[model samples]
Target chain A: AQSVAQPEDQVNVAEGNPLTVKCTYSVSGNPYLFWYVQYPNRGLQFLLKYITGDNLVKGSYGFEAEFNKSQTSFHLKKPSALVSDSALYFCAVGAFGNEKLTFGTGTRLTIIP
Target chain B: NAGVTQTPKFRILKIGQSMTLQCTQDMNHNYMYWYRQDPGMGLKLIYYSVGAGITDKGEVPNGYNVSRSTTEDFPLRLELAAPSQTSVYFCASSYSLGGSGNTIYFGEGSWLTVV
Candidate 1:
């Protein structure tokens, strides 16, 4: 059984400051991690994914995530936050040969101006 | 490019009333999925299909049914609408399973409110 956990329900950061949303996973085999963002009344948009690659993965909207195998974590990061960056972030995990993805509870990010 | 399109962007249903949420993808992807999102809870896969005529239940399939009669369309049917069923429904598609090219594309979502 594969699962994902987002330890924070909400994260607040000041605009222009670096923002980090934490995510961790548990899987029996090598994991395929992903990050998605959802805006108000919209579906989730893919941010980035880490299947087998460098430890750091960059994604859309100036966002990036670090895939730390030892820590079993894939935390999303942005060098500078914007007020419009406020949205819901989700972390998902899937393994090879699995067609489905298991997602975390989701973390709401709010960028204060 | 209307990647993934879902009908009935917003809907209101009474208890025991049934409805079908329509989904279609122009990407010609082989895998399609249906998910429900609730407050604070991430997307939960309700059903998925590898191709036409093949469908499988996901983590949460209770009170919901789905069919994949065509490669481009995957419709989710709600048999008996309940207050618990009041949530936003999303339709997604992927080119492959888990890999570098297997990024899933999602629809704008269908907001269903069961009274």
Candidate 2:
């Protein structure tokens, strides 16, 4: 079975400051990790994914996430935050041959301007 | 481009009533899924289909049913409406290449309220 955990339910970051949203996962084999953002009354939009090759992967909207194998963690990061960055963030994990992807409870990110 | 589309953007149902949420994908994905989202609960898989004629239950599939008649269409059915079933439903589809190359695409979502 594969699962993902996001410890923080909410995160607040000041505008123009760096931000991070933590995520961790458990899987039998190598994992495919992903980050998604959802705005009010909208569907989730894919941010980035870490499949293999690189421990650090950059994604859309200047967002990036680091995959730590030993720690079993993948944390989303941004160099600087903006007011428009406020939204609900979700972390998901899936292994090769697994059709279903397990998602975390979600973290609500609020950028204070 | 209309990657994934879902019908009945919003719906209201009374107890005992039933409804079907329609989903279609233009990408011709072989895998389709239905998920329900509740406040603070993230997304719970209701049902999924690997391809036409093949369906399986997911984490939360008790009150719902699904069918995949074609590669592009997968519809979810609610047997009996209940307050517990009220939620925002999402339809998604994906095709795998290998080495975890699958990236699922989601529909706009349908909001259902059981009164």
Candidate 3:
């Protein structure tokens, strides 16, 4: 079974400081990884995805993630955190051709202003 | 563009009551999915449809039913609503299967509370 684990339940960072949310996955084949952000009372919004090629993938709102094959991790990062960037982040994994996605428990990001 | 739309933004249902959550997409997406989000927990797939007339169960499909009658409509039905069914339901669609170039668009979500 393909699954994703987000180690932290919450991450606190100061505004303008760099932030990282760790994610790890276990899958049988090549993994299709994705990052999604959800604001209060709203559905998730797609941030970025890693399917093949580049290990470092850039996403919306100045977000990026590095896919490490050796460690089975795809951690989301932002050079500078903003108060508006605080939200719930989810890490998901799916098989190369599968349509189903397995998501992590989610990490609540809080940007302290 | 009204990417994906779900009807009845909020509803309160009594135990044993039944209702349907309607979803539609105008993007001509071939794949549609229904998911429910509980407090703190991430979204769990209730059901999914590959295309019109084809549907399958997902991780948490025990209390829900889904139907895909047209390419643009996928409605989820909750039979004998239980307190455990209280959660926000989301409808999503995708043009391609999972992976690159297959980004899923989500609806605003239908918040349901079963007492």
Candidate 4:
């Protein structure tokens, strides 16, 4: 079974400061991790994904995440936060061959100016 | 591309009434999915179809049913509208990795309320 855990329910960061949203996962084989962002009343938008290769992946909206295999973690990061960055972030994990993806609860990020 | 498109943007149903949320994709994806979003709970998969006529249950599939008659269409039906069924529903489509692409595309979503 594939499972993802986002320990933090909410994250707040000052504008222009770096922000990080933690995510961890457990899966059978090589994990396919993903990050998504949802604005108010909108569907989730894909942020980035780590299927194979580099541990660090860059995504849209100046967002990036690092995949730490030994720690079983994939944490989202932004060099600088903007007010428009405030939204709900989700972490998901899927296996190499499996089509099903297991998502974490979520983390609400607030960029305080 | 239009990616994934869903209909019935907002709807209110009476108890015991039934409704179907329609979804379509133009990306020629083989996999389609239905999911419901709840506050603080993220998104829960209601049902999914690997291809036409191959629907299967997902994490939360109790009160809903789905059908995929064509490669582009996947619809979800709610048998009995209950207050618990009120939620924001999303439809998504994707392809298997190593093909054209691996990213899953999602629709704007449909908001349903049962009164």
Docking class of 2: medium
Where's the lowest-lDDT run of ten residues in candidate 3 chain A? A94-103
Cα lDDT tens digits for candidate 2, A69-105: 9999999999999999999999999988787888899
Where does candidate 2 stray beyond 4 Å?
A: B97-101
Model 2 sits at an interface RMSD, in angstroms, of 2.5
Q: lDDT of each model, Cα atoms only?
A: 0.93, 0.92, 0.93, 0.90
Candidate 3 Cα lDDT to native: 0.93
Candidate 1 residues A17-99, lDDT tens each?
A: 99999999998889999998999999989999998879999999999999999999999999999999999999999998888
Q: Arrange candidates by DockQ, highest first: which order? A: 3, 1, 2, 4
- Cα lDDT tens digits for candidate 4, B1-115: 6889999999999999999999999988899989888887878888988899998898899989898899999999999889999899999999753112267778999999999
Docking class of 4: acceptable
Q: Candidate 1 on B1-115: residue-level lDDT in tens?
A: 8999999999999999999999999998999999999887888999999999999999899999999989999999999899999999999999987323378989999999999
- Residue ranges of candidate 3 with Cα displaced over 4 Å: B99-101
Q: Write the per-residue lDDT of candidate 4 for residues A24-86, one digit (tens) a residue.
A: 999887888899899988888999999889999999999999999999999999999999999
**Candidate 1: where are CA atoms >4 Å away?**
B98-101
Expressed as tens digits, the lDDT of each residue in B13-64 for candidate 2 is: 9999999999999997888999999998999999988899999999999989
Candidate 2 retains true contacts at a fraction of 0.38
What is the iRMSD of the candidate numbered 4?
3.6
